[model samples]
Target: MAKRPQQSLHRPNDPAMLLLTSLASGPKHGYALLKDVEEFAGVTLSPGTLYGAITRLEELGLIEPLESVERRRPYRITTSGLTALREVTREMGRLAKISATRLRLSGEFA
Candidate 1:
């Protein structure tokens, strides 16, 4: 069976993309991010997975920590993070549109 080019955007998805997308709305702590991601993506991320992404994002300067007195440290997306997120989603949208058009032209779309 033929697979859609758009399917590449799913499975083994980028944690950075999910994290950056979450931060797109506003700042959020680790727990908040977990909840938001689950709510939207229907995927539960382990603490390790979440922190691993968080560490990488920090290293890339895509996210920054906010001052927190409690154990829970909140983070906000940096300008660069927003830019990356926008570019990625825009590309995904473009690919989806292209795939849909092709499917329609082939009379495969229902």
Candidate 2:
């Protein structure tokens, strides 16, 4: 048997993906975001981790907070953030097609 060369692939684990993708649908507060992400991605980000990413995204103009009625604040993706998400998803889509093709050729997929 011959060993197949491994191809480097862009994974969807980038820290901002969760928040950005979630906000792509609509705005959400921290707790709502945490629940939504967990429900959708099955990953639980600690408060510190989530806040850290939130702060960085805000600094980069990728996300902004919405006016809130109470303590919890909601956030929406900025135009720049949507652009970034589109690019990332496009790349992921290309990789997915490539992976599917490779798997089919290798007889690993039906």
Pick the TM-score winner.
2
Question: For every model in order, what is the number of clashing pairs?
Answer: 0, 0
Cα lDDT of model 2 by residue, 25-58, tens digit: 8999999989988988988989998998898788
TM-score of every model versus the real structure? 0.81, 0.82
lDDT of each: 0.78, 0.78
Please write out the lDDT profile of model 1 over residues 1-110, one tens digit for every residue.
Answer: 74332232242367767888889899999999999999988878899999998997887777899988488889999987777666668777777678879777534432
Clashing pairs in 1: none
RMSD of 2: 8.5
lDDT accuracy of residue 107 in candidate 1: 48
